[model samples]
Target: MSSKLFLGHRLRRLRRDHQMSQTDMATSLAISPSYLNHLERNQRPVTATLLLKLAEHYDVDVRAFAAGGGTRTGPDELAEIFSDHLLADLGVPRYELAELAHNSPSVADAVARLYAALKEAGRNPSLASNDDARSVVTPENWVRDYIQQHRNHYPELEEAAETLGGALSDPLSMQEPMRKRLKNAWGITTRVVSQSELGNISQQFDAERQLFLISSQLRPENRTFALAYQLALVEFAGVIDRMVAEAGAPDEGIRQLLHMSLANYAAGAIMMPYGRFLQACEEMRYSIDRLCGEFGANVEQVAHRLTTLSRPGARGVPFFMLRVDPAGNISKRYAGDQFPFSRFGGTCPRWNLHAAFQAAGQVVTQLIETPDGHRYFTVARTIERPIKSDLSGGLLAIGLGCDIVFAHKLHCAEAYDLADAPVTPVGPACSICPRLDCGYRATPPAGRMLAVDRNAKSISPYPFLP
Candidate 1:
């Protein structure tokens, strides 16, 4: 191993010696657990902010965390390439990068590798490599900005959504008030147009005419959500600005995009107020129909809301939410708990996500077992996205599923046998996932060397035992 890799290993060892979990360390530093894992594995470069946080949290001197202090060598350039991209794209002078190498070699190595990968892949491609991306944010400098800036908070929208409560249950009854709010806030009229008039099922804003068109298909819930999304852009522009400002980007455009995406989350939360939504989720037992009726939100909207409750201190059940098309392409994912996820490919085939498609609209349940014997209860069901039929847009069937631990208090527990009943084995995805026997596997795990014992072969291409 290289000096950089050695340094990361030593850092990880030190962290473990302190008896701290990755999540504990990440929470303390206000960084993602995945990023910490990357840094420990020498996959990500360390940053000044992170180094300072570690020093304050662990009460260690700067060199103590680097190679010269009690450690040997760090990783090679390749290892650093795997960290995050933003540090690589810092646009800092080479001398500064070299200075960091001398003082914070672990971080410098990571940033160098990140820049190497970025240069190799050109500037735009995100899936340039398979192993480095995180679930919530793409592996880019802009994503880092999104996270580091706000510490991932949406206080303003949270406050606004709290104030806008109760306008959802009877959208028609509240339409006048909602429309007035939209007009007053955005200077646009919220007009309910026929589905035929809507060129696209989307809620479009005609900036020139100052009119916002809502599809006729929109029920009280859809209308409320659309109105909130609009109001979020206008009423909460400052909040958005603050988020962008705090992101402290290496690039301006990426910073703006991250700002808009997060603003969308704020809008969604506003439509489904966090406190009420959490209460409704527990009360309704997460039944799509029941919760939808009680909260005036759709199934997809409810699932999406469940993923965004990652508010610090007052977090809801941390969930890993994913939506997959019939082809198994993971179009959307949110890692509320930082559970291991694949950025390059699809999820485990044995997961109930694929099975959910077999019976449209019917919820499917499964107990999934990872190779390490970790078990999770999964609930999956297919839902449509609601689009225009003119071939302009049409709803696609996507499966929505969440991890099991959070399902403990859910009423759906009775639906599955959580006992020692054998769980269907699964892997993260084809590339890094270890289940080679899966007919659905598209690739094999890296560095795996299979030895054939002519007479004894397990069902999988790779043996289950050593």
Candidate 2:
């Protein structure tokens, strides 16, 4: 068909989708049926004035309102959402939008909320809408959807952890038997001391001493974690290496660290068998303290393990766990699901992970919303890392957060009044968030132009009609 005919046909399709007849649309546009029909049939073309009115009346992009001169294209929901009057109207930058989509939905959600906030603030001057500030859904997006897609549990680690338990003839002893086994198996020894004397050696193998120094700072849970790491190094190390190799981390520093973390987790599981731990966790009603007590582990270790339940068949509760510093820097992130975390930089200021510090040690529960309308439950608490020497350094204060699905399986969430308790709000950094009205926003929403109103006030920080 001719370009005019194609455009006319597309226009007709859009109008029909909206269930508007030619006469109805003509009446709305203050035009005669004959004229509207001519436009629809490609007998007459749309004028600049008509295009502007169509945009204003239909609340759609004039270009979108127009018919295509060329053939159809691929699925472009992102592109269509871009055409959104709210985004283009705000003058959010294109590169920013592209980055947000590519980076993660958490960032995109943040950007969307920030943009909405800006628009709302400009339209209505009230902080009441500040409630919108907390709608960040990035963490959950990363944890539940993205990370969960990958298997968290490694069978090789599980088998190795269990097998090592057999050789440790004296299971009750913390040091000698475990140490002897290490030396015999991998030329590594296990050492334990007071938390103060633990020093920088959390778990280090000295080839010279043939000793593996494990700080007493390690609680049973941490000891288990350290034990697991050591076991992986000794017994399952090859298997763990194979696992990472299969995962193909591409030989980078961070990837190497991640590989080591995975190895540590596998070894740790050997120290605390998965089936035993899962049963213990369930029997304990997912109580971190009780689990720690029964398994001789630490809270962090338990919480960390909770996230690794992604084994194909024999899985424990899958949880997304993150450790963030007081500064809101995500220090450690493990996705039991697909919740997106920025591959780089700090989380949005609005997230509750930062708020966990205020209530230190107390469990804080939250319900978060994303721009695309994905919702999730989050539970957060502050944890103190054990410190050793005065000269050496102090323990770092960090916050831990887990996705709500696992929270639902936990004892703390069941006891807490989540129904009435205020949920924490969050978003990705302003650079990634699409939110426009964020007073805390460091920059404008991507693709939106900053509109400064002189005469009349806009509800958002920057209001530009697309």
Candidate 3:
């Protein structure tokens, strides 16, 4: 950790969110307006005592002000973004990028958004048909950014889902009650149908017949989740639509995707009611398997639920989750902190998430140290989800992890001795990784000189000049 924490942007946002002016906020904190200004401008580092004061006064979690201070994007990400040849020649200093992200996260986020648009278009050049070049944000990427902006915690959805969950107790056994509610309340009928009937779709709701057809191929957990999702759509359609309207999604496709995601979030919340699930997580010491049995959810579903425990005052240990296919494409990501994520490529190959594919259905754990020296405890496993009829046999790996500081709270971490754990050296990706001696170097490091010595075969394929 650095001696000074530059969390001016976060503090400023907090103050603005409270509708408090600098002078007012300073007076409340027993600090001068000038000092508060200095703090907001990154002129002075935030102190531990001040962070405690913020928490005490605002009733918020103090962990957001720790380590990198929970910035929207860290310098690591900025560095990775600028490493591309298209932007590398711009000669943006590393500290400037950090200052940009720390002092003005919105602008930093704009940079990231544009980068996303470019990467998405680059990935599918023939499909890029948007003439309005100002913005080409992909549907999934845009919704993902929106979710991250809100910290993946939708208060309205949470409250509504919690209320519904209380009304419908025992999430695992709510299928019948939900079916009844759908039929009685919404005048809709739900029935499981064969794969041939539903075709490629997992679930389909036909409006004309007012019938909901769920694929019989789904597992027990998935079936319950599918029903819960349909119930969420019926129950929270207004709220979900209003959220989409407020989002100002670029197109209808994006709007629909966001709608699906919010409904999915609501369904997850319904299944794992916030208060009870948090209690269970603490009581069980964050055991994935135990929680799976307790909630009747699959590993991937349980892990995804773990990442959304980000309610303001009653927050759980901050955990990041990701889903990756066998081809190393990261399809989903959530939570942000010291963890190094590749902007668009596969994250560090050294991470054990990729290794879990070999040992399907088993949990794999690793103590990983990022290039920037942030230690994390990772829990990864190969998850098998019900696939479309056409694509029947593709396995995805789900990785769930948190900072090493919170590792002790997880039951899975009990096997490792934190004091002397064997740590894996991981980087953001091969394109921007600083390591020059890794035997598994897939590509040369960006923005570094490579040493070409054909006569002497080095251990690393792409040896670089230090």
lDDT, each prediction: 0.60, 0.57, 0.84
- Report the number of the highest-lDDT candidate: 3
What's the distance in Å from true for residue 142, model 3?
0.9
Number of the candidate with higher lDDT, 1 or 3? 3
Residues 284-389 of candidate 2 have per-residue lDDT tens digits of 8777778767656666767777777554445565455777766565656665444433433356556666677788777666666544444456667777664343
Please identify model 2 stretches exceeding 4 Å from their true place.
1-151, 165-177, 183-188, 192-201, 215-224, 244-259, 390-407, 415-425, 436-439, 454-466
- How would the candidate models be sorted by TM-score, starting from the highest? 3, 1, 2
Q: Provide the lDDT at 77 for model 2.
A: 23
Please write out the lDDT profile of model 1 over residues 1-466, one tens digit for every residue.
4333224555576577679998987888898899888877667777767777767776655543453333211222222233233343433444454345444655654454345445545544655665644222334433532342232336566776667654443543435665787777668887878887866556788889999998877656667678777777777778778867865544556676676677667667766777777777777776667867665667777777766664433556655567777777666665444344443346777677877777888777777777656667666877766543455333334443445656566666666656755578887655445565665555434444555578986565554222
Best by TM-score: 3
State each model's C-alpha RMSD to the native.
10.6, 16.9, 2.2
The clash count of every prediction, one per candidate, is: 16, 67, 0
* lDDT at position 314, candidate 1: 53
Give one digit per residue, the lDDT tens place, for model 3 in 1-466: 7477867888898899799999999999999999999998989989988998998898757766655544556677788789887887786888898888887888888888888778878877754686775446888888887887776889899999999977876644878877888899999999999988876788999999999999888888888899889999989999999999999988888889999999999999988889988999999999989988887778878888888887777788788999999998788898744346675667888899999999989989999988778889998899886654457767899998899999999998998999898999988778888876888889887777889797898988999986
